[model samples]
Target: MNTHKKQGFWHRFFFSLDHKDIGFQYMLTIFVMVAIGGFFAYVFRMHLAFPDMKVPLFGLVTNKDYNMLITNHGLIMMMWLALGMLLAVAGNFLIPIMIGTDDMAFPKLNKISYWFFLISVILMIASFFMPKGGLGGGWTLYPPLSTGDFGYNTPYKGFADRFFTANTFVLLAIVFEFTSLLMGGINFFVTTLNKRAKGMSLFKMPVVVWMINIASVLFMFSVGPLVAGTFMLLLDINVGTGFYDAYRGGDPLLWEHLFWFFGHPEVYVILLPPLGILAEIISNNSRKPLFGYKFIIKMTLLAGILSMMVWAHHQFVAGINPKAATVFSILTIIISLPFAGIILAYIATLWYGKIRFTLPMKWALGAITLFTLLGGFTGLHLGASVFDIYAHDTSFVVAHFHYTLFPTVIFGTYAAMYFWFNKFTGRHLNKTLGNIHFWLTFIFFNGFAFPLFLLGLAGQHRRIADYRQFEFLMQDPLPLYRHIATISAVILILTQFIFIFNFFWSLKKGKRVESNNPWDSNTLEWQTSSPPPHGNFETYPVVHHGPYEYNMPGKDKDFTPQNEA
Candidate 1:
């Protein structure tokens, strides 16, 4: 950005309040969190596979540390990596550029949000080092364990010791992370709604713009209950209030209700951006107009509506009303329909078109197949109360969760990064290294995640540091599968360094982009200079077409830029 002029070290190193710098900053920071989370997954998975052997870099895994590792791993991936990247990073990067604006509606608030996120990161990491080695109460932080159960189970016992502990940092970090998300959501809303370039109507906006904004609205509505509930939880632990403490006459199920209410919708908050990214990648590579553009938008809105109503399905066994459980069960199953429709529309977009199997497209296909298809089908089993009774809290739930989130969060993120890498760096990543990274990641990701379904069916439960105690769980396929999964995870983590190497190496020495629109895609971001400039477009752009206008009969080039007449 304005590289022609010389700049000081501090100026070059720090972001200068540009949306691009902020977005990229969010992305890089999230990747660091992801690396740490991945390492945690490796440590725990290694322990699970071979309980006798000590983990490398970390010593023996006790029950407490196992719980802490898994719990913080969940928090780190969900809060820091997924939410940060999807809502804040993608919204900041895509909304302004795609809608043909120079910057976010409120830039200062945007900067503040990143600072809050960084603070949350610090608090989260610091939580582990605090007393009792972080809250092992799981990511949900459910009551009893959340109430006083975990406190009592610790090394410090009896009323003589302090009732409250180090896990407070975890909750505190979450408070800040959520607060940051809310601020970023406000910025996305204002920028997209008010700051569009001329002719860029609501309908004319790209699918990603629609998806990110809709995700923001869904989060805004659903997280309010959790936000208020989280404050109550903090009070329960710190001040000895009995908000969720069942032992203290507080209803533990209330915590579940508040959590899943936001928790279920939170899934979509992360899912939609990737789906939108996939839409852009799929359409551009296929050289076809997006199929069912308006229909996709309508279905997404319907899905958001249904997402709020189905939160109770997670509480079917929590002993809510039978009729109420039935309603949520039916609604849970129904919510799948909108996403199914959206995915089918994407598949239809690929039909009878010139398909290019670019690295991004391969990753997109992996996401649709893994997240939308396999993930969707398995989720149905959990939707029904009868099935969930058997599957919930078991390895199946973990598998299904990974199947859904890993593809979108991990696979989908890779796809988007590769697709937009040129725009971000103004240089091409080595296709050779990228191909190796893609195949290894795609194959190994499934290698690890797929076996958990069988383990769940075999009656294996979650969060057990050592499964050797249970003779039935020690059966042939079980241990064998564990080994398979652990080995795969190791390979998967190692493969990412290839991408890391390629990422930084390409920034300086990789082939320079010969043209602005290297991919010949129609989106406005591609129409600008590579990496754009401080204010983005040199002149104000007037949108003349929808984002995906490829393969026009009259044009010499198949693509039509949105700003073109």
Candidate 2:
């Protein structure tokens, strides 16, 4: 198999089609985007908190700059950080190994997806420097504002020559990014279904494999409408089409429907994989049989299905029909029930078992308890039509989103990284730095997000760039709360540098692994070398047990390897 072949630097990092190498590419890019997105958050938050003060690293945050900051922050984090890590990176890295395959079904296509993603990032960034400036029409990119002024900018006769405006570039980015994910999703689905080793049945698959598949499927199904919507909106900008312009005989609400239709399920597309990671870590660290393995799978499918049905809840206050809102409200609440079952199953998995406080598990515990709990409960408030009307654009909604999303996107990504550090680099990340990173992250994250919840309840609208300007919005504790959130954001963003250092430092100098499976994990990936050979395994494995097998009475060790006969 020519496993000893060496490649040049470009092929190794940038130009290669190897799934592992591609995963590395995705990982590096994801972190870079994180820095960019986090900095944007710091800038906008500073603008919100201290009205006219020029941010230190960044210069003065003009109204336009403020809009651009908040808009791009949401886009980068949600688009780049979340999907880049969970779907593109995780699918490429883990799907082949965990499913007992050497590589994806289409390796070159994997490379193409990443290039598409790279182009998308560049285009979005490029949008900021366009003649009309970036699309700060809010992250949702609603029309009228996004479509531009009512005059020559409306499309056709007024603007037939110029098609590549600010919004147009960003839309192009979205189109490219969607194309990339679609390709990756197809790769994941085909690879898992077609490439499993002999005797590795669907029921015996690792929870993560199922998760990536589900996330991919959800993304595939949901993103189509948004893709169409983006194109329509793009035509509205460049080609003089009025697909979303009211004056041009198009309805803006159509864009909203197309957006959230994908938007709500889009959350689960990034979310479900982390829950899968949590299950794996909890079972390994607690040394217990994962409770309700079958049930969790069933619940996950149910949740995915319900995810599609509840997108309308996002549009309840958008002037949709009351009956439609009521239907959405009902579906939104119903969706929570399946996740309840899943969370209970996790809690039960750890019930009275031997629990280890490893870094991955610590993050998992935080995700399961504090992060998910706060996020989930608050989510219920927004699901109801009545409360949503008030909280729709308040600081409370922002708090709810980060509470839910940051956990899955940020905490979940960290847990996976720490848990698999040995496998990725054949070395352990420094433990001291990991804990410090987690605790400081936990403390400051709460300090930042929790205050917003109080401010939301206090009627603090989220879109305001300056609270000091409005007499009604200038209550005593509200300003105090803004300061608290902003200060914590600075520390939270800085705390990540410690992790970045740990990652690179550990890569070169941390303790090298002598064992194949340091975690004593039951997954097939762990059964291979620390960093597996060119083609994952020396010999393809045949699985006998399910992914999580802990503390069986006859097992020599507490955890049973999946490949063991």
The candidate that achieves the highest lDDT relative to the unseen native structure: 2
**Top candidate by TM-score:** 2
Kindly list the per-residue Cα lDDT of model 2 for residues 1-565, writing each as its tens digit: 4274787888798888778899999888888788888889999998888888889998898988888888889988888889889999888888999988788999989999999999998898888887777668788888766665433343254453355567777888999999999999999999998999888999898888899899999999999999999988877666667777566577889999899989999999988999988888998999998899999999999999999999889887789999989999998999999899998999999998899999999999988876557999999889999999989989999999999998887888899999998997799999999999999999999999999999999888888676565675687877898899999999999999999999999999999997988888899999988787778888899889888889999867898888899
Please list the residue runs of candidate 1 whose C-alpha ends up more than 4 Å from where it truly belongs after superposition: 1-9, 12-15, 147-164
Residues 1-565 of candidate 1 have per-residue lDDT tens digits of: 3443544556543645778878977887888888889889988998888896889998888888898889889989998988998998888878898898889999889988888988998888887776556778888888767543443224434332333355567778889999999999999999999999999999999999999999999999999999888888876666666787556677889999999999999999999999999999999999999999999999999999989888988877778998887788899999999999999999999999899999999999999999876798999989998899778878899999999999998888889888888897799988999999999998998899888888889988886777777999988889998889889988998999999999989988988889998788998899888887877888879998998889988999989999999
Stretches of model 2 off by over 4 angstroms after superposition: 149-161
Assess each prediction's global lDDT (C-alpha) against the native.
0.86, 0.87
Candidate 1 TM-score, true structure as reference: 0.96
- Where does candidate 1 clash, by residue pair? none
Distance from true location, Cα of 419 in model 2, Å: 0.5
Q: TM-score for every candidate vs. truth?
A: 0.96, 0.98
